[model samples]
Target chain A: MPYKYIGRTHSFKGKTLWEIVGNLKNFGVGRLVVRNTVVERYPEPSYYRILKVETLPQPKEESLDNLRKVKVLLEKTFRGVTNPKPVCIESASYKTDYRLIPKDEEQRYCQYKAPVTNEKIFPSTMELPPLMKEVLIREMKIKGEPVVEPVMDIVYNDKKRRIAKEGEKPTIEIKIGLGKPAALSLYKGIKLE
Target chain B: MFALNVISKTLNLPATKSAVNFQILRWRRKPRWVPIAKSKQFRIPQRPVIIEDEQIELKRLFNNYRTQMKSIKRYIVERFVAARAITTDPKDIQRIFDEDFARCNKINDEWNSDIQSKRIEYFENTLEENINLAKESLQKRLELEQFKLEEAEKIVTEQKELSKTFITADNIDEAIERSLANPVDYNFAVDLDGNKFYNKKTL
Candidate 1:
């Protein structure tokens, strides 16, 4: 070998976005590019289709080896789920971890099935704290009102894509108690009774 | 002692006056602009070595943690989406707001009425106290005025009694004649035998 590496090696395998897009015809518009790190995590394909490209001006004192950022409009598909809207990729373009997918493999890339996750149904209500439950029952009894089970509805944050799918059995059950530990070593010498 | 003086001089600090040499040590990282030392540039950090059993256990624990975290995150996101889906009519929202405002206003009005009653009673009490104070001061002022008038009248009466003896322009000639008529010899002296001399010249 010509030389052996002495210092810590980097995990980056692809060129910077600018290096690949800058050399292409029409700045590689209508081309597919994928991040290797994302592909390594998921089995399904995750990629970006370039819709527009804008090259940023380089600073006069910057060295040639320094990474340059480029603004690119892209239609992103992550883990085979395509985002309805086009997104702009700017700050992350300087990362030297993007690889261009060839034109011939675009069809094969699209053919990969999107992974489906089972629906999770969380409980509609959770029990009140022990002290609060007792207090509420006492108050209701004093007021001569019918005392029902003291439970509060579980409130959730509002989002566009919900993980709790409709018309499906929940994959995991959420019980109102102390959760079970993953391993007994985590508890160590603690008593569980 | 010699080293302390040198150090103080180099640092431009005040000279140490006592035997004890107190040096301030800075506990902080180097500034970002300062370049790494040449000796440390080529040094590689050693990776931590773990036993195979511990490594496996840690991996299992980490996987379990990640899976649980992912499920919790997904659940929160789904709940958020479902919450956002619920939409209420603007008219219904307005009605609810109106009802809430009316209830608040009623309570506020009741509080205002209670405070107003207390304020009215306080004002009445203060006004009664002020009236009594004014009456007392007026009575004292009237008594003082009466005393002053009585003193002035007495002085006028005394001056009227003494007016008969006072010389005026009209009685100047009569007063002078009376004074001349009443003149007496003041030159007489008494001898050893108690003899009285009417005038020394005559004696």
Candidate 2:
């Protein structure tokens, strides 16, 4: 496989790869090499792709030896390249990319019918049911909008209160249980980011 | 424009380097005065400046689309004429419009598909290239690691052999430390850059 840039963005600084290109409009570089990151992993040394850029520096040699010199050097360098590749002379650029997410799998669900629902069942006399909410940040975001990483917290609790009768001037009594609300928070990240 | 230098059947191109754009830090002042020790500069009228590549690309894209729209007007007028020239047969004109719209949609679909195919091909090539490079590098690393492991294995074997040859100073620790100080080719050392040692003679 050939090297390909995943994205043009360098989300991480200084770790980006660059391909050396010739400035054809002015000085024509004889050969170009891409600057690659070094791979230190082994059985062999991990290699960041390195593009070599070499050009003849001269008061303009009158012969065709300019290309020959580069050719010779390249020929000497890549002696074992069985499938010698040609370089893209016009434009030489590599993409330095940020991390990417993996693709999602296809939707697959197994249909199963459990027993019928029990209408009358309670874990305890003082247990509160769970409540879930779907929240959305319905707003148009600009480029420099502050990024807020949402935090989620879950809690559970039970409420205990006595019944009240207004006719006898009775008052309502309430007690806080040790258990908190069993909740899960879903934060909406900034969109149009 | 540059001078072309030909050498050994190849032309040498002048490589132009990127020049640093001078940055003049500016701020507002209340007409302050400074002596020889200080250098105060005056501010000019404020104007917009191009600071990023995105702006340049946006401008180019806008101009391109504008030019394309200008060129596409003839087709729009033709369609309008065809639509207006109908009086007796309304269905025919509607059919004409429908046909025209369908044709347009088909044309668009075709064009898009064509461009998308090319883009996909480009991406595929790019992906392949990168994958290959990565694979190559990974394979090389694996080999190097294996080589290192083999070297380590050799060190162990060498110690075993030396144990038979003669009991060294303090088991293998002293021997290994001495070896490390001298630094024999353990085969763990690797330079991926493949940079040849610079030679003045070669230059």
Candidate 3:
């Protein structure tokens, strides 16, 4: 009799990291592995280069299909940018979502350039609120000082990966009013009054 | 009771229902220890289908939204860091502290002066009120003393007038001789017309 499949189907497409590394010589070191879920989300090439792999002792009672953690050192390159640091893949090693890239395709994957776009410029300063501006102007007049239009300086915090870029000519202006809506259909049949 | 029962039957009145005690079980997955049901062992769940165009559009919208959100988050973080950033220079910190202290001191001085003026006014008003109260109390005491002196003088004058009738040692013989010559009688009878009749004994 033919065997019947049980339960809801999983979305995982590729074998687990151990399934491929355990069979290969030298634990599949110096090999490229890609996650299908990451590829589905990003159009850019994203893969992990296995540097080292270590198999953990399996429990006597538990089956091989049960979750087992394996330590693996990986050099990850996501969205065409290679990370400078080596990352350890342990908990996710049990997930059956990693696929080893073929030797022939590795050269083609390495040939693609990192996508570059024009740097985005943000406003260096923002205008003060209307009431605040009025109050500042009145105070300046009372002090007999030259009245200048009060504006607040825009400051950016440093981050590991910053989306905002520094460049001449600001493309984006930070303002203190209702901005133009992105979708017109969402605002249909609505009146401002 | 029989008539009531007949009326209830005619009206088709419904019986009162009692509250039910029950436990509401929530929908959840079976525990890991529980084996799969025999009938559902071979059952497979259907995958959701999505249109290619709609998927592409959603992806693009999500990408744009993520980029915008990242930029906004970075901007907000940068603004917060800038606002909270402290000068490393001790001189700058000291200068700032001094300026703040001076401003606070000036405000404090202004408040103190305002309160001082009010306190002075309050003290002057209270002092005048206390003096007026003392004066009124002293006047009342003086009037009371004068009234007591007059009452004492009236009592003394009445006592001096009554002292002349008092029998002294020097007037004893004359008082006895006058008493002998008068032979006073104390027993008397009065009629309804208030006429008194004295009964005298023959000596």
State which candidate has the highest lDDT.
Answer: 1
- Candidate that beats the other on TM-score, 1 or 2, i.e. the better one: 1
Q: What digit string (tens of lDDT, one per residue) describes model 3 on residues B25-101?
A: 45897798999788877777798787665566566566545544555556557668997888989999999999999
Could you tell me the TM-score of chain A in candidate 3?
0.70
Docking quality level of the chain pair in candidate 2? incorrect
Candidate with more favorable, higher TM-score: 1 or 3: 3
Tens digits of per-residue lDDT, candidate 3, A1-193, equal 9965556667888887878888888998998999889978788889999998889876566654685568899999998889999999988888889998999999897677756786566666666657767987998899999999876654444444233444555777666544444444544798632
The alpha-carbon deviation from the true structure for residue A173 of candidate 1, after best TM-score superposition, in angstroms, is 3.7
- List DockQ for all candidates: 0.13, 0.00, 0.13
**lDDT digits (tens) for residues A1-193 of candidate 2:** 9964432232222211121223232222232222223211112221111234444333265332222122112211121122254343212222332111111311111112344653332121111111211121111134454444322211213234222323332232111221211221211252321
Q: What is the C-alpha RMSD of each candidate to the true structure, in Å?
A: 13.1, 49.4, 14.4
Ten residues in a row with the worst lDDT in model 3 chain A?
A156-165
Superposed on all Cα atoms, model 3 deviates from the true structure by an RMSD in Å of 14.4
Q: Model 3, residue A42: what's the lDDT?
A: 82
Expressed as tens digits, the lDDT of each residue in B1-203 for candidate 1 is 77666666776785545325577456898899999899999998786777655666677666545544454456557657996663499897898789999999999999999999999999999999999999999999999999999999999999999998999999999999998998778888999999888868766
Could you tell me how far off, in angstroms, the CA of residue B128 lies in candidate 2 after the best superposition? 5.0
Top DockQ: which candidate number?
1
- Give the lDDT of residue A123 in candidate 3: 66
What overall lDDT goes with each candidate model? Answer: 0.78, 0.39, 0.77
